[model samples]
Target chain A: MKKLKLTIAVTGLNNTDNPGPGIPVIRGIRESQEIESRIIGLAYENLEPGIYMPLMIDKTYMIPYPSSGTDAYMERIEEINQKDPIDLIIPNLDAELYTFMKAEPRLRELGIKTFLPTMEQFEERHKANLVAYGKKYDIKVPKSSTITSHNDIRKIKNDFDYPVLVKGKFYDAYIAYNEDQVTNHYNKISAKWGLPIIIQEFVKGTEVNVVALGDGLGNTIAAVPMRKLFITDKGKAWSGITLNDEEMIRITNDLIAETKWRGGMELEMIKTNKNDYYMIEINPRIPAWVYLAVGAGQNIPEALVKLAMGEHVAPYHDYQVGKMFIRYSMDMLGDIQEFEQLSIFGEIEQSQLHYPNTQKI
Target chain B: MKLKKNIAVSENGFLFDPNSGESYSLNKTGQLIVKLISEGKSEAEIIENIMEKYDVESNALQRYLDDFIMMLQQMNLLQKEED
Candidate 1:
């Protein structure tokens, strides 16, 4: 029953047209009534807006990009740990997760802990692997194929119709109405995000998502289903409201039980006109829309931290339905000097920035 | 040749078009290019300016600029060429 104090590190701080989950995750941590904490932001770029949000991030250090390999990234983390011993870290980016998962052992040796999916659990849920994953678990997933060449895009017509979804490995998805559009998206996404690109059967229905956390032992700690009220042209949920969908929750629990999934996950599912749910994609971390779950009553980040600390956490049974999260963008005023400091020195202290908490944001 | 009419640009690189009610966030380089484009700088003029300011090679910058302008066209933020 005692209040716990902890220091947490979080990545994926790029909250932009396309967002990373860090800011909302940090907000969830700050809202925790049971845990008092200081935030240490792990950023890949100096310009990640969270690096400038002083109240949300007490201090920040730049880490090498995942493409730089986990060795360099872990070395940067070690350097950060030497300055401030991190109690736990929540890796929020899909691109960077494999590195973090591979480094989990070394981090634990340095007294840093994390709650993440096992490498097996992580790999099986990948876009390329999801069809087999769904079949093994008896869940209905849209028919999909992973293609490494442009020729594969042409062949997709044999299995899928026009308007199939073409997706990148780490990001970007486009609904290609014809083969030419598919080729366009294929070239664009492959150039930026690399292969193998995913071409999924278009499941017609309302798109919905579930943000849930699992306890590694097949128990779901928290689950919240949401429907987007407004979708950006980029296909991000600009405004979304929570739903108390029992079937969505059941699918979430079933997937967690079957995979023994650990840590935070978002299930991007499409409910068909016939009311069938076709799992589309499984993101292995808390979604950018996670603040919705925190606001809806379950503080997933807080509970995830506790689970990482090897503490007992009970499954959340109920949350208020119809909670809405409407996202907005605000300019964060930063001085040239602050940018200079972060860019030149690769580190910045909160005290030096003189930035306002502006919780109003 | 210019940013769409009534487009609002911010120093932080957030772009809003009052015409379409669409919002976009651009990186630092994107902001610079868009600003140059809106200032009536020709493509070559923008490239020459950026080459002097940034370390990127002219050829690579040219390729990137072309890609970015294509993106602008795709977003319908560019005015239609007067036929």
Candidate 2:
């Protein structure tokens, strides 16, 4: 069979200690037998490791941060698309997804397709709105409330007990043992991620996660549940294995069917001792551990591209149950010239030597 | 009565359950009991073998074996009787 050839642009290239999904997602796309992709990496910072990782990115272009607003963000994407003609764009960062979702129509005008949740689907699943989302969707979730000021911290005890979770709008979650600790966390997280910090009841249980993709028509293209075997101090999974949890899969399917979520998402849930699964957070993009799903047999990145192209994608029925992924970091030597090119010009292209003769795009 | 067909038990007492992708480390006694179970030994036969090898009373060994088997079952390492 002739593979579908595509020029794909992807963001979230920050593969660090707290990694992004870009590199892993790219790896999945590269491994697809049915898709031939020329991967163009979109990076916010020059030091994003995916930009310099040998053959992973055919070209790297530094783009404005999403905080610069949709106009500036789309301007850079427009420039990149004009040069390379991106067939599909997979924005992989939580911070950048809203910008891309807002630009979906503009991107469509330029013939660049993206599979992302609608504005309503994206807004409903936010960390600050998770409790309401769970209630509306008929899923169990820990009791949580949003607080915008320091005054709300003292009032938390009236609702929730001590040792609650203080979470930021986008990232950073700290377990606050008392009101004073909540105040400290509130000040810290608000300074970084801004106002409306979420305070959630701390449920004691095993943390399990599922990386899934949903078609706009309510079909689950792929779903893989995993348990973290080892976690970093920042609460990122360093090593994880796929699981055989029917409950996790069912919940993922139900949520996708109800919301008709249109892109890649990660479901962070806590499995209690009583076997009740509580929805803790919903990340509206592919997760850093997504390559594990690909290894387990559901190449979600590839499927996502197919969906974005408006092609028919069959749902994945099973994955190898025991597949595991252990992340490791190694230093790679790079010339000053390469760094200077990307830093000064904001774009760098790999030479043809990086690609195999048969695989060069 | 039996370990999962795809379960792997290494000589160093490392046990791997392929069905759930969970692994466990066992002590000498734990490894011996699992090995005997894999060899299709019955509960009484397992206890008799352990009593002869270790300085343990029959009743005490029986109780320990029962507990160990239960743990294995809970971990999903042992195959169901129907299977």
Candidate 3:
């Protein structure tokens, strides 16, 4: 008899071997003899199997516009399905969330399972929607306003502080100056994204990501919030440390519970001087540091699969603390023109000593 | 290098990852799987147990569970338990 293989349809996987922010960790999972799975990168192409082959996938989905535009990259999922049906489709990235949401009914019909949120639920948690969710959840998100038109940007320049955050339709967020600057930037963004403008307060402080798994029934499986030390201009988590912030965990869980969520999530939050966590963007997908969670003894991927299998997962207490994760490369250019565009901190070249990457961590 | 595991056995999902200071919360099925791994259950036996409970397909479960555990070992959470 042929052994059964549980297939995971991975969306947003680009064909490459470079250690990217996502996917490699999934590969690591396969390499460790922990899980059995195949991958679909961007609708076409499969990485040939090798040491990395167990973790490498050659399939993808192209839905869910980024702060930019929807890439239609997910159209390939259908092609891969024609060969062998996927058991579960993990919308492993923010870009694929909308794609998964749209494909939810079809996926269910095909017997593929996924913990997908509704479009409204997804939109409601978006950064621009943060102000509204904050109002409802009582979480302190920065002061933000929606931009339905170019004139909205003009109104914002006079109203709010400069060096403000300009959010895209997807997850990529950047900062801009006064109205003209915002308009120019928005024009470029809208041209590429076809998304409405999201002008928000530029928050300052140590940024952190609270990675958690939630039951659709309002219970939490695990939560690991991290404080970031470095970032790309695009606002990806570059270097960070995992800390046990009861306050942060409580507030983030409170918000998730209120929303009645059922899936894995990663949220970007800024711990201000007042020690308040001002809510920023929320990514509904699992984070790139999912391997970090696995390292910490909380394997969300394993937990998530069990839940999907309808097995009762035991809820374990979080007793670990003060673990740090650092990503290092000689390319740490402290002085770059692009750094200021995405950074809240000014010119100060921090040491390579303080940084750590789990690969090098 | 090949992967090894030294997971503790009990009803509670108490995983103390000595490599990373992060503790874990595991569900019942997760507990059983970890126990099986600690007891040195082969991949085939684990799959048989999984099939007994889950109404879902096995091939997919095997792939996911295989990759999932491998990830644990790569992260150093799974190591050979010294008898």
Off by over 4 Å in 2: A352-361, B1-13, B17-21, B35-45, B52-55, B66-83
Whole-model lDDT values for every prediction: 0.88, 0.89, 0.62
- Report, for candidate 3, the interface RMSD: 6.6
Candidate 3 stretches with Cα past 4 Å from truth are A1-5, A15-35, A39-55, A58-76, A328-361, B1-83
Q: Show the lowest summed lDDT stretch of 10 residues, model 3 chain A.
A: A345-354
TM-score, candidate number 2: 0.91
Candidate 2 per-residue lDDT, tens place, B1-83, comes to: 99988888999999887545579999999999999999999998898888889999888888888899999888768888888
Q: Kindly report the fnat of each predicted structure, to 2 decimals.
A: 0.00, 0.50, 0.06
Query: What tier of docking accuracy does candidate 2 attain?
Result: acceptable
Please report the candidate that would top TM-score against the real structure: 2
Q: Tell me the TM-score that candidate 3 gets on chain A alone.
A: 0.77
Worst 10 residues of 2 chain A by lDDT: A352-361
All candidates: TM-score: 0.80, 0.91, 0.65
Candidate 2 on A250-314: residue-level lDDT in tens? 99999999999989999999988666999999999999999999989999999999888888899
Write candidate 1's Cα lDDT for A1-361 as tens digits: 6878999999989998888999999999888888989889998888898888757888888888999888888899999999999999999999888998999999999999999999999998899998999989998999999999988876767888778999998788999888889999999999999899999888898898999999999999999998887999989999987775789999999999988899999999898755689999899999999999888889999899999998899999888676788888898787899988888988888876855655422
Superposed model 1: Cα runs more than 4 Å off: A356-361, B1-83
